[model samples]
Target: MAGIGPAPILFNEFFQMFMRCMPPNGWPVNSKIAVGNSGGPDSTCLLFLLQKLLTDLRSKTMARQSIPTSVVSLSVNHNLQEASHSMAARSAANAAAMGIEHLTLDIPWGTPPFSDKPVASQSMEQVAREARYHVIFDGMARTGAHSVAFGHHADDQVETSLMRLARGTTELGAGGMRRCRRWGMGTGDVEGGLGWVGHHGLDRWIIRPLLDVRKDRILATCEEHQLDYVNDPTNFQPEITLRNAIRQMLTLQEEGKDMVLSLLIITQSALSGLPQHISGSLEKIKVAAADLQETTMDLEGGLHQLHGAVKVLSSRLEDVDNEVTFHLKNLTLPSPPSTLILSSHALPAIVDPTVRLALVLRVMRYVSFHPWGSLRADGNRRRTSIQRIIDTLWQSDGAPPFTAGGGVLWQPAIFSAKKRLRVGTQCLGRRLQLGERFAWMASRLPAVPYNMLDTAILPSKLDIDVTERLASATSRGDDFLEVLFDCRFLVRFDLSQIPEELVEALRKSQETGVNVRIKPHTKYYWPKVVLRKPSCVDIAYATLMDNGQIDTFGHAPWVTMKYIRLLDAT
Candidate 1:
């Protein structure tokens, strides 16, 4: 696959840099890297060079140098240009010729649902970027790839910085793109801090090996190697897009090479230094996280420790079995039900404001089961609001329960009455429900077992193991459960536990004469209602006899169902 070799020293340096990005800690031995290939010079250069690096590493006899990096080239077709699909095909073909694995995705690249403007006039580049990353993340998920390698060079960094600056972004914008970070699926935001949140922590490292490489060297290498790549004409159309405009400006600055290169280095350093920058800020937050506990009405507390102030320890939780509550130290505390309270003086011990905000963000994330980047299209906006809410809570009189983050509500421990005030962390979703079987958040993605009675047997097609995995995939409290396989169906899992006011609107079918059925929840969740004469199992059996299919929708005033199909595996 090579007609020419990249400069030995230059290639070796960048190769080592990419190798270092591999997690030093435990990772799958067969860790795969998904290299984005756009059939363009920059991407082609990175791809071929990576191919050479892996080949050399594996071919070596020395144990120390024998690195086995499973690699795959991903070509995403956004249907932007007329020949875009053909370009993607060529990318896959090139990977085939080089004996590397390849994956091609046909993404719908029209105006994104996240977009505000009309389809015809919307920014194709922005929409394409989002679509491309979504495909990349999904491909990584399916292939078990650990990190995504991009061909973005120093020039790309310059362009991103300039574009964000022109649009008036924050300090993060000044740092340009992160050298290594985590990108979660369906979550548009990228996270640079500690910890991983996805089921397998797949939302990880966005490596830019070419961050230090110049655009000119990349083009030269690709040409010298006779690599198949196309120069995107869109890059020269500066007036059409901000990034293109930055690129055009860079071409006119022959004397400004050092300055541009320096700026890139500065941006890279700024991003990489952030972890160390905030390292000291989380100490107090960590302490608070470890201090959580549950509580109640006409509160009482007996404590012996530093300061003697009460702690609604973050370490305590009501449902110990729930994954979200796995870290709690006590099930019950001196606070209200569905709430954890700490001495109001708890945060004052740590004076650093950054640490306080970080701690609050951590608590919110832990409670919400949402990682740093889980916010949807409005990620930045939501984060800003979250920060604002934290600030407001910090300043409030510490009495009434106030809504903080869009999804969370906070209540400060009552002062004077308690001998002193205690800070409270209450799940607002829970309080509104008053008395329920599960938390309000859980109702959003509900999943109850198929068995409603002792005799009810799940259809054989839903393998016991797969079914368990599928059931776990659905949120226990979430209202909608979509099973995306052979026994295809969408359901509104029963919410007898949730308050009547927070109920989800049920789904109604538009197609007439299509046999529709209403299924029931697990017998344990709604024992009384399901115990009545006709159970969900009975209805399903009746449907099976009539239409030869056991599938049915949830039969409830609040239950909405779609695409119900129950296949009999046996």
Candidate 2:
């Protein structure tokens, strides 16, 4: 409001539309958001806009006034350029003028906490991004903020899409930057499948309110308000980086025409198919899949539901506003997932061949951030690697067992007991250290990358320290300690003194054994996965219960000492 150059009505109209990216309605409480303030015109405008929005909301109604929202500006000093420190100082002064607290995070260079250390020849962009997100995560933790806001706008989207096309991207890559996403350690987010779900609101979202605005308007607003910001001279020199080149080229093209808008329209066109709503399609498929049976499940009926869900999902991946994620429940089958055994003699008359091919890509998209794994594939074209796999998946009768991104598996558990296809992450372990870093995920929250560290030592090497921490926290008389293990599960440890009644219940169960969903991922995937903890050995051994076909992905529970004993309790 102070520095915006547009007329009051024009500015109000534009700002209102921009706020739609991540509506304030979804938030249940007054949240403190951390802004990635670079002291640039875009971010500077964002900080000012948030300040105005919070103030305006406070004055609007009783409901809004009750919830107190504040902004904390964090300047990430990568130390890459000589002006980095000065930029941080500039941001701090601006934030102080607006009565918002400002913090500067210095980039750290070393081993364990950081990976992919920058080299001279390698691009510094990724390194700077890593350092920036590291500080952003640190800032979020220190300030107890739930959402981190960035300054990406409409023009950035144009550049991003073009850059992805230049780099040879898959379908997911071409979809452009997300407005809101959950990213971080818990719930396998950093490993894959749209990151974690942190209930405590320790950096769960990256919100972009300025996505609806264009760069020219943004600069105009800054000019009107008399706001001072630094320009990155490197952006003008396109040859320095691919992004810069694309950005410069787009600027030149848009000199006399609306090239950015045209590209975005074309991008939408490329997403293809009518935009599908996600209201009921996925639920229908999940309900049917959950009820699949070998003796009772009508094979034709089940495929019908599965195919429909895949179609709807594929159509809606373009609508980044709709959140899509997947999880698997550990269930036992009559045969190993590596083998395919179908009772159906022929393909269903109603389900077409095209549906089968689309299902593989669509289903893979549902569970993975990169379904095609950075490679372009077309069922109609010279077979790409993923296409070859998909082609095999829809063989004459049905495809054989196959594995893909993030240890994804396609197990045709099609015996008499279960006439359904069981798809889930394979048994390969993903060893992760709690305190280290799942760094790249900070900016792209929720839509996370798949690769995480795989430790070769004992499985406990990753979770042991987490165990100790939970133990220490539990000793402080915490009632129930809930913690996530390796982004796989959200596990809760029973720390309170065991009740005598429950002890008796355990004693009774000890006679027969009770089903336990001890691990966090298991609890998440197998809602009914209750295991019988009859002994320490059984408790330790309780896993996905694979038919000796798959191996554990080193995913284990992180619990306190008392809960470890509970694992032994039936």
Candidate 3:
């Protein structure tokens, strides 16, 4: 909004769209924003607009006042095409000409997707898209940016929606891409796959300001500004990709132009609003299902939203609502939710199957070790496994402990007759009788083996340091590091708390370049210091003693864990 006034008619509309698509709270005053610049028409236009916006913002602020808000263009060179490097250089040069800071992320040629030749494949676009996502996020991490903007326009949305519908998709998928979503492009099915270290505890946001704008308008902006841009040859080759084919079909049509425009309008008018409705329903269910009013705690030193206790309350069933009511024995709520309990009653009362599936998935995303963003694979097989779990939960017959996707362990919550009797008497307001059956208790599946298959699948260790993988991006001067462990817990380690002996050894190893590691402690007391190249990323050993053993909570108290909000589904 700072740059909207005194702008050309074209740019005013662009700025309005950008503001509308921003996060609810908008960006903080001193925050930095990163833009993905491909040197193409859309991205080029965005870069120019952002440059003008920054200039206006600087001029508006007092000369003595410091304006820390900045924008940087991140150009990623996939190296799959011959002109990739040149295009990246061109983009950098253009950004520098506009007085904008720029960074180039070059993907290695012999990476997994390019490990084989870059031949025509059905999935090559997806592979390239994922690679670009990784490169952009890596750039963001280095730049200390929590938000990244893209140049996906309305045309891209239409192509995407049509593609998904062609294959098969749910209502949400049919709605196409979101204007803003959780930054989760590179996260895969494996928990902590990318091994991202969070300097800021806030979740990453992806912004597409151009989603509502037409592609023609973007091209016109580029032309009006006399901007130079490149075109990816593969995009014009219809034989190479489905998107290209669809694009060619749409572009070559001279007769049905009105129909095409009408279709886009229909999509914008009708389908674009579906995600908001679904999100609202999910939020309603989540709020009604759990009571965290008294237990939500905000801690100091960047720690936030810690939950002390949570009570599952009863709610009236709606047309598309889950009727499950959970009553913990003796009126005592569950402590901090290591295991979550849900009742099986009235599941059939929920008329809509889509809502039912969505509710279960939402619960799984929360309770599982993998957060919502980490579950990238949404194939039929995964959904079928979840459906099977739902079916099992729906049945009254008691089943043994079962494991589902995202490492969520499900089993029946058992109670003695006395406990049930106490619940019946104490929770009479809920209108529940004694000796009633309670269904599923969901918990984080343990890393150790309950079976041989578990040994093969579960992570061998959770505390391993991935500092080397992210060494180039992390700050070297920080005495502590905040890690989003297992995508659920924000674990902060105070490296300054290590013993003097260990610190001396680490200092020595830093200069000598010797690999010196302390012996694994048998007790949960010692704070170990690891010295990686460039900086000290942290991995504090919290579980040195085995489970069920008595250990001092005061010992090695430098490490603290807090729960992070993971409901952002992008």
Q: What TM-score, computed on C-alpha atoms, does each candidate reach?
A: 0.52, 0.60, 0.65
Question: Which one wins by TM-score: 1 or 2?
Answer: 2
Residue-pair clashes per prediction, in order, are 33, 22, 0
lDDT of candidate 2 over 152-260, digit per residue (tens): 8766764564454344444344345666655423322332222222333332567777765677778887887888899776566533455654454345445543444
Please list the C-alpha lDDT of all candidates, in the order they appear.
Answer: 0.44, 0.46, 0.53
Lowest lDDT 10-residue stretch of candidate 1: 437-446
The ten-residue window of minimal lDDT in model 2 covers 561-570
RMSD per model, one decimal? 16.9, 16.1, 13.3
Q: Residue 384 lDDT in model 1?
A: 66
Rate residue 129 of model 2 by lDDT: 63
Which candidate would rank higher by TM-score, 1 or 3?
Answer: 3
Candidate 3 lDDT tens digits, 250-311:
45432344434433432354224323332233223223223223232111101111111111
Q: What is the lDDT of residue 443 in candidate 2?
A: 8
515: Cα error in model 1, Å: 17
On lDDT, the candidate that comes out on top is 3
- What's the true lDDT of residue 358 in model 1? 40
lDDT of 2: 0.46
